[model samples]
Target chain A: MPKAPRAVVLLGAQRFDPTLVEAVKDLGIKGRIAAITAGWQEREEEDDDLEEHLATLSVTTENLRLHARAEEVFRADPEFHKAHRERQALLRHRQDFYRIRLEHALDAAQVIRQRQAPEAILEDEAHASIQAIRDLDHMHLSRCAIDRGEFEDRYRPLKRPALAKHRSEIAEIIAGSEGVAIAGGHVASLLNRLDLFGIAPMLGGKAIFAWCAGAMAISERVVLFHDSPPQGVGAAEVLDAGLGLAPGVVVLPQPEFRLRLDDKERVQLMARRFAPAVCLAMPERSRARWKSGRVESQQGGVFELREDGTHALSVARHSVPPMKGHVAS
Target chain B: MTGLTPLAITTLMMPGTDARKVDEFLAGKQFPLTEGPNVTFVWRGDAEGVNLRHWIYGLETATALSRLPHTDLWFLTLDIPEGSRIEYKFEVLRNGKGEWIEDPRNPNRARDPFGANSVLQAVGYEAPDWSTKDDLARPGTIDQLVFDSPSLEGRRNVQMYLPARFRRSRQYPLVVVHDGKDYLNYASMKEVLDNLIHRLEIPDVIVAFTDSPDRLREYANDEAHARFLTEELVPDLAARFPLYDRPQARCLMGASFGAVASFSTACRYPGFWGRLLLQSGSFAFTDIGKRNRRGPLFDRVVEFMNRYRNEPVAVSERIFVSCGVYESLIYENRSMVPLLDATGMQVRFVEARDGHNWENWRDRLREGLSWVFPGPLMFVYE
Candidate 1:
């Protein structure tokens, strides 16, 4: 495996209007940039607009086509494909069971937060409630790890000729590229392709730029969150362990559209529940760069959620470092 | 006075008030003046007789608005329930011939295919912000799917809503909407779907928007129409697009007669369509006598509803039924909810203050779609 990446830059959703060119310029990345739009699945080849946009900066992009390669591997080895399918089903089942507990724990936390009581007692109970949610998240992630570990142990996917051939090609692309740009789409599909090809090992010692689902996939943990869904009370749950490229951060993409930030209780609850790891809310035009296991630089009104409320990154910069001390729950 | 509710208009109704005071009261004040549950409607100009014509069931259809003693202002105040949204027009009598016109003072209007009506939102009612197009939300594209259906013995054109960033490898849930054109034109279906999906309120799914050539006959729970949707359209769509084959991912939705078509279609192929969203269904059923008072159009609708009520089988896994309290079909929709729930299926029922119109159906789309096919908000992390 190569050395750790020089830096990892995460951004908001880039579908409607992308600020990727601005981010790329800020990083001073020139020459060929390896692009992974595997999350786009069958439409992975349809990156004309993205390619044109990058061409303006005089930066050529090479799509890794991890999704297509994964498909090829599956076709070549039906046994590995069946095992992958079974693993996905197991993960889904785990998530379904996890949600039931997560919801109840969140509900209990909310109730305690709202209860009319003395401030000191309320603070204690609120912390306890948040801990319960954290415990549930930890438990869920651990179980997901077990499922993934079992699959990897049984199949030993990297040893297989089908996946090994593609991995070597992808490694060659990364070796020749200045930086890697991962675009967002279906997060699960994106993570699945990333995991199957084992691209994390090759991502070291290069500048990495990812946005939306891409940002979440590279983080320490993949957290699915929405404060106000149409039906039922939405509780953010741990999907699985991420690529761990950008450690000590839980990246929430498009928070301006997903989260009810004005609600202090919900904000505080989310921040405290995911304590140690910085919960970053990346809205449109937002950018955050991680280097040396800390937030090196950030732009836009990117928010760092706290126990009181969400503070802009300018005022909350100090909180991101302690996040590195405790990377996992 | 600019923000005064209709209940406060009594001060202007005093006998001593002159035209100057009335003009001052009218200047810049939004109408119909809504204060709590009381809404005061004001109409300006001369007429032989003026009446407030509204489409609210169980209430007087036309209530005369008395003209102030010395002013041209005609005012009528009524106690409208909080959270109720109603559409009304002023019936101005000119030379013994009545002409119905939208409110001159009320700027809020709801447009339908026929025309537009003045909108009155009571105290707690607010139009959903998500229904409007947002520049930030990525818009979904609509494509036409033309096919020949042997079941209907004709060619059918369906407009498909492929969500932004749609992928062929990902299998999406399917929502087949009846009366598709009306939903697109009046309900703002595309905008709502785009916003809802962008906001993670509902999953990014493929929508098959279908319209009938002969809506009255075909949407009356006709057997051929059911076959056309289940046997023909669905198979073609599945073959063309990457859609989930499971019943849980399939849904059938419509409003009024179109709603009847969705319900009957799901019933015919039980467990095939797992979700049903029926809005203001024209379920005119007779508990005792077989008399149908809703005219010839409702003859077949009443027959299907009556038979379904008697059997009350579990057709779908989940059913979301909504109706306007002001609509004549409210009683039927309300009664059908309990019967549907009794079938051991998940049932959700919602009621609004508005009448049977496209906007009312449009307002319920978010809740219906989200509840049926909840998005990544609840489950998927990436």
Candidate 2:
């Protein structure tokens, strides 16, 4: 089997500043890293953030318009557009019910927090509650997989004549670049485009650096979360199956905003919910390194969610290594 | 203190009352002296500055709290009704910009998108005896679950309060509460439910606290939020819980945008929620006469309120609206009452002597919830 990508996740905000610059130097890369800002959506072409960050370095940045290219594919094929829209709407419809059930589980966990139950019983309740949410996530993911599987079984998007030119172009660009940098934006939009042009296969056995939604999109699963939003209520949700470049780690970008750090119950629940995977909070100036498909180091206040309801940047990265593939629930 | 009846002067105690909601402000404060209909509110606070104003919502403007001599404290005694509960904050003007703050001593509070407010419960506003913890009273079980949403591209929590007396053979009413966490920590809803059910004040209900992933964007008259409630939440809840089958048995509730969530859901999915318990709803509208005119912050709220006004539809069988006299949304809520009446729905509109906060909603529960899901003993007491 191909070795998992040697990926390093830096915080989304101020990701490329001195931190990313230092990371680039640490990796000792001399060639260009084909940077993918597909996550930026409409501003996919804008690399000012990347350009400015690496202005002094010999390492070059190449912008890949995966988002634009995906849009072109949709525009080129009417049948594919109809299928994609229908797929999205169906997932949304199904996801509503999934969310309802998920809320029920979270409420149960919240209730468990209030009771003066024994530690053992509390653990049991917490474990069961977390498992329940995980199970719901699994089911929703399965349905999504099926939906996409059905679509791909017929369309065979990569092999289609309409997508041949774009597919070959991306393959050649990624092959030429020594590394790839993915930026953040609308995660769903980014993931869809990356999936359409088949970046994951091309990214195999490559050096990858991602931040924010970019970091989240590279992992085995994409979990969207927020604690206090300007307009909406806060809930940590599993958005979709990711590219699986960084395995066994749920990268939580901007944990300061997304996490209810003071709320012990929520902290404990989130940690236990995405257990074994190490719900790593990628705050600003933080980094998590994966070498040969395993976590090698953590720095700059990078922390992992623990079962005991504590967050820490465990000194020993070898203690919880990243597996090559998905850690089955 | 002024122009009050003998009963209104009966100095109700200010300590030991439940905070009801703690996330908003300090709790366990409020002394009320009441006659038959009106009551006097006495609140104590410590001030660090001269311009100590009570930035109470629902009312027209802030009122200055008379500072006591030789003390860091200030007192405000205002007369209101027998069952009015309001939310208020102390605005200390320090270095120009007003600092809105919570009552240091008062335990009861309510929270909105803006911030926290101390709650004031008037006399005769009994928050059901069962709402209080009694070792003898059998409590319900609340469980948390995750709900995935593709439309909003999110997954949120759903808090379900199943009564201690749940049985597969038995059916119960469902009350969907928006702003789930606020209702839980702030409103003390779970305790309220246990107490209400134990007392049989309301029918045994399976309440689902439907949390908002985005309250401002999702809850403020947004159809997707409504769909999440009706299409996703309720249906999924009905499938699992042995809930009362009729739409009339279900209730949707919230305070502020949460109230807007309930109102908009009821409007969008008519009959989904049999009742709406709106407390100081931010129902901004300019078309409900000149008094309803509002600002740009209220533009989206105005659009929604106008849509419902132009097409007055039967959202719920009965609606209970409670807005504090000292709340920011009083005019808008006042405009809503007449419009609700015009919709041919049985409406009970209450003007709380307090402000826009959760205590106002918590105190009104006895009236609103009991009316919506009146138990068998409702007539016996009457």
Interface RMSD of 1: 3.5
State the lDDT of candidate 2 residue by residue for A1-329, as single tens digits: 54456555545455434467767777877787888888666668978868777656877887878877777887888888778777766775676567657877887877876789789998787678788888998887787778777878988888877677888988888888878887777677777878788777677656788888788878888887766532124567777788776777787888765677777666777777777777888788877777755677778888877777678775535334433322211
lDDT of 2 at A25: 71
Best by DockQ: 1
> Runs in model 2 with CA error above 4 Å?
A1-3, A6-12, A15-18, A116-122, A230-233, A316-329, B1-382
Question: How close to the true structure is residue A218 of candidate 2, measured as C-alpha lDDT?
Answer: 81
- The i-RMS of every model, in angstroms, reads 3.5, 21.1
Highest-lDDT candidate: 1
Model 2: per-residue lDDT, tens digit, B147-261?
A: 7866556887888888887887556888888887777776677787777666656767888887765678787778777887788877878889887666667889888888887
RMSD of each candidate relative to the true structure: 5.8, 19.3
Estimate TM-scores for all models: 0.75, 0.53
